[model samples]
Target: MVKTSMSHEDYLEAIVMLGGTTEVPVRSVDVANKLGVSKASVNKAISALKEQALVIQPHYGDITLTDEGYAYGSSVLGRHRMLFDFLTKAVGIPPEVAEEEACQMEHAISDASFEKWEAFVKGLDV
Candidate 1:
């Protein structure tokens, strides 16, 4: 619950993806490339994230997530992975379609709905 827009959530997730397991610092260029957005857009998003204390970016330096950012990004990424698995593996959706749909749904889904959906997806394992 970051109380931010879906686009902001997307930026957070993109940063986490670029940073990877070691949580390495990620450059704004990398975020722009990963998101397929312009550098200006990435800068704007980064500025907002900085103001929220979610990320830290030194002047003319790479970006790194704060503890809060990592936690929130982890949740966002988990939702994405879970939905991707459920859509593609359980419901037989095409991978590309599932990826797109999951991205949209992840930001909008309520916790209660996700709880039920996750339970159903888990049931598919049985």
Candidate 2:
């Protein structure tokens, strides 16, 4: 079985997708809401991320990813999109199910598998 190094990558990616704007700001509350986790949990994760230098919270109101954080999150989101699309379109699954399953699958996908899926989707994109 392949190991996923950063399970929290999903939360960070979901945060950016659900409620994020580099131009504006993202609150930990929004992350909590999006993730359906408690604010306390989000705060703790954010603190860990900061200590790891993966994110920054210069003020109390905003949470933003650092370059490394954004990079990981972007990859996670990209994999999520591809997996969700494959589940919904190719497998004829419902959107809601696909979305939930994609959240699980994205973290487990390999770079090679992700590349193939992305390419296949793009090939279908005429």
Top model by TM-score, which number? 1
Please state the error at residue 21 of candidate 1 in Å. 7.2
Error of 1 at 17 (Å): 0.8
Global lDDT scores for all candidate models? 0.86, 0.75
Clash pairs, candidate 1, are none
Residue ranges of candidate 2 with Cα displaced over 4 Å: 1-6, 18-23, 59-61
**Backbone clash count for every predicted candidate, in the order shown:** 0, 0
Alpha-carbon RMSD of each model: 1.8, 3.3
**What would the per-residue lDDT of candidate 1 be over residues 1-126, giving only the tens digit for each residue?**
456778988988998988632257888998899999999998999899889988888985888888888888877888999999988987889999999999999999987898898898888882
What are the per-residue Cα lDDT tens digits for candidate 2 across 4-104?
Answer: 24657766686678645344458788788888889888888887777777678875658877667677777788788888887888889999999989988
